[model samples]
Target: MHDEYNVQAGLNPRTVREYDEAITRVSLGYKSVDEYYSNSCSCHVVQHVRIPLLCIQAANDPIAPIEATPYSDIKDNPNCMLIVTPQGGHLGWVAGDDAPFGAPWTDNVVIEFLEHLQKNASKPESS
Candidate 1:
């Protein structure tokens, strides 16, 4: 099912099967493949983010390959930060004390980022 959407179905209109069309219709409530592609692609709107946006992507992720990353779009956005690590598969940032088990390394990174935000929230901006 996952492959049906990410790999085979989402490839192109020519590659989309009847099963994929039905799944998109039922699950996503999208009327057509064109609509699905237009709405589902983040590259279309990532640059429009008004707030600080942190995007951590694994360079070797199989599900969402690094080549598809919106590098140019994100680079132009002052509020967006894109971090592409050499490793970490999909959501598998297994490291720190949690290696081989427990939470991912992103837990600590996210917490630290939030903590920094909280600490700096009260500070006045420099002229």
Candidate 2:
């Protein structure tokens, strides 16, 4: 099934499964599948990251199911913020209420957040 999805995306499907199976076998041999994923997968990796991270997830996104996002892990990480809007397909911020189509709302929000971070960050002590 995963192979079929890769083919649909115009990629050579043969390599995907082969690579995954190889990695899985190695992980199992090491008896560290959980540890490997904990350090690699974004779901687990996010928990240990110390920087301020804002995750804007669209609730209606089909490719990335809302249920899969590790909410408990995110909550545990003091630096992570999970903002789930009601609508917005993969990176699609087509907001209602006279919202413009071209200027994605998400980009604007991200920009504002970055600016706020810049303002809050401690300045360098120059000689």
lDDT of 2 at 109: 88
Write one digit per residue (lDDT tens) for candidate 1, span 16-127. 3354464564467676655666677789899799987888999988756787689999999988889899999789889767476978888888888788888888899999
In terms of TM-score, the best-performing candidate is 1
Instruction: Note the clash tally of each candidate.
Output: 0, 0
Residue range 1-127, candidate 2, lDDT tens digits: 1112222422333543344344543534433434444444477587888999999998988656687688999999999988998888778895456676566787778999899888778677569
Q: Where is model 2 more than 4 Å wrong at Cα?
A: 1-41, 95-99, 123-127
- How far does residue 102 in candidate 2 sit from its true spot (Å)? 0.9
| Pairs of residues clashing in candidate 2 | none
- Cα RMSD to native, each candidate? 5.9, 7.6
TM-score of each: 0.71, 0.62
